[model samples]
Target: MFKKVLIANRGEIALRVHRACKEMGISTVAIHSTADSNAMHVRMADESVCIGPPPAAQSYLSVPNIIAACEITGAEAIHPGYGFLSENANFVQIVQDHGIAFIGPTAEHIRLMGDKITAKDTMRKLGVPCVPGSDGAVPTLDEARKVAAEIGYPVIVKATAGGGGRGMKLARTEADIEAAFQTARAEAKAAFGNDEVYLEKYLDAPRHIEIQVFGDGRGKAVHLGERDCSLQRRHQKVLEEAPSPVIDAKTRARIGEICADAVARIDYAGAGTIEFLYEKGEFYFIEMNTRLQVEHPVTEAIYDVDLVQEQIRVAAGLPMSFTQRDLVPSGHAIECRINAESLPDFRPSPGRINTYYAPGGLGVRMDSAIYGGYAIPPYYDSLIGKLIVHARNRELALARLRRALSELVVDGVATTTPLFHALLDEPDIQAGRYDIHWLEGFLAREES
Candidate 1:
């Protein structure tokens, strides 16, 4: 076991990792930017290091500064919570070269899954189903049109190296293909510096489902079931829940086994998520995230497992504490991502929180790093907290979420809490009838 680990991110997730390490009797070094000197993670960590100025490029994403922080603090490992450099393959290699353990998947696996086209191709060969699309990168407009035509109309053009809904354009018919192809390529070039693009038959009302898998990097792995993340806006997940309202035991067992077997074959290590688009009774592999997801808490709640601790154990070459048989998900869990943003427009609202109060009681968990008077820095993601609730079933979980949301309070700046409150009142959301495009339409109707 490592005596100490350095957390290479800020905000709630950094604090999330710190707590996990603390429980395992491991001291933590929190690296922060100058703007985050007063952040919660920095305040609670056993040791703190100022990596650079406010901008993420100069601080949280600075590989050299992060490495230097590890050296100065004598930390043996780094747990990149979720974003920033968590999935950066180059950073993983550099960390390994410096003899520091990265508490995630190997650099080889990261690089392999980092490219969209290669990931789909690899999954397809591994027996995981994928959406009908281009075999590889379509570099020209004619090639894009051909793939689109073969995939049928209503195809989606996506960047070979895209994520977070960027570098994606939808073509509903032949007339829309040229513009969609050109726009996707241009966006891909600007966002990832890669002009490559591909096409996939777009499933109009598919549900976004993902299976969480963990491995020991020795051809052994297990799956913790699935999370329904269909509530999304602009392709970004807004809320997530375990034991998807639609998926039953038989379906879960089937897909879960397939994902576990696939990752095991590749000797994948640490935490990874195999995301899929589910429509009707079929599942299509969309992409695989090579790092811990932001919605990991809901998975932990249902399965009663500490994923961060498991990540550390695997990185240190320790055996996983539990196996597939040991993972018996007992309850339903839901997580609402609370962001520091104004509703209706969803614009960022960063400022000092005047009053902060978190919901409490059995089956309720609040993962946040903000406090009263903590000035939220505008240089990072607007997500301020995650409000999660667990219960014996989805219905009970929904009731608990409603009560918990009412108890929560963060004043002086607007928050998206109101959005969740409104969602709770909607019949479609209550019955879990929404799909990936549901939230966008909901917002559009609200605005009109």
Candidate 2:
């Protein structure tokens, strides 16, 4: 076990890692920007350091600042809790070069999975199903156009290095492809510093299902099951649940085994997720997130696993105590991402919070860093908190989420709670029949 560790991100996740480390008897070093000088995570960790100013580029994303903080605090390892430097392969290498353990996968694994293009190829070779797409990155506009034609109409041009819906364009016709190709290339270059792009057959009513797997360096790995993240807005997931209501016993077993095998093949270490697009009962591998996912709590609730602690243990070279046979989901768990937004074409809402309250009771969990008098600086991600609920079944879980959302109170700034309430009342969501496009259409119907 590491004597001390550093958390290189902020908000609820930072606090989350703190609690986990405390239980493991490991001290923590919390790094915060100037804006988060007095945040809860900083106060909770045994030691805290101010990295930089409010801007993320100079603070949390600053590689030298993070490494310097680790060196100064004498931290043996660094735990990047999602976003910021979590998925950065170069960042991982930098930490390793300093003889500090990066509580994530090896740099090689990160590189292979971080690039959307290379990941798709690996999935294809590993016998995991993937959508039909270009064999590799298209270097020229002409090459992109040719690949788009090969994949047929209604294909998506995506950055080989992008995630979270950035650097992506949808083209359904020759004219659309002609107009969007260069813009996508330039946007990809700017956002990800890579002009490389690829084409994929876009599935129309796809449900995003992802399997969570953890690998240790000792040639052992296991799957904790899957999560249904199909309910998305603007290609970003808004709601997620565990043991997707759609997957059957046989399919789940097959997917779990295949995902574990894929990770083993790469000799991947640390926790990762293999996301797939499921439409009409067929699963097509989409991409892999090389770090802990944002919606990870839902899986933890159902599986009764402490993923944060597991991440630290993996970093310490401890083999998993359980295997595939020990895998079993107890009940239904659902998560609603409470983004700072206004309803109907929601946009980012960042400001000082005046009143803040979270629900309490069994079966409900709230993960947040904002509180009364907490200022939500506009220099970073829009997520404010995650409202999670667990129950004996999906129906009860939905009802519990409704009550929890209603109980949650935040003043002085708008939130997406209203939209979440409206969504919970939808027939498709009620039936667990919703897809990514369901939220938009439901909102349109509500407005009508």
Question: Where is model 2 more than 4 Å wrong at Cα?
Answer: none
Backbone clashes in model 2:
0
Per-model lDDT: 0.95, 0.89
Residue 395 in candidate 1, Cα distance off native in Å: 0.9
**Model 2: lDDT of residue 441:** 78
RMSD of 1: 0.6
Per-residue lDDT of model 1, residues 199-315, tens digit only: 999998999999999999999999999999999989889999998999999999999999999999999999999999999999999999999999999999999999999999999
The TM-score leader among the candidates is: 1
Off by over 4 Å in 1: none
Per-residue lDDT of 361 in model 2: 89
Q: Write the per-residue lDDT of candidate 2 for residues 242-326, one digit (tens) a residue.
A: 8898998799889989999988877788789999999998999989998999899998998888888988988998887567787
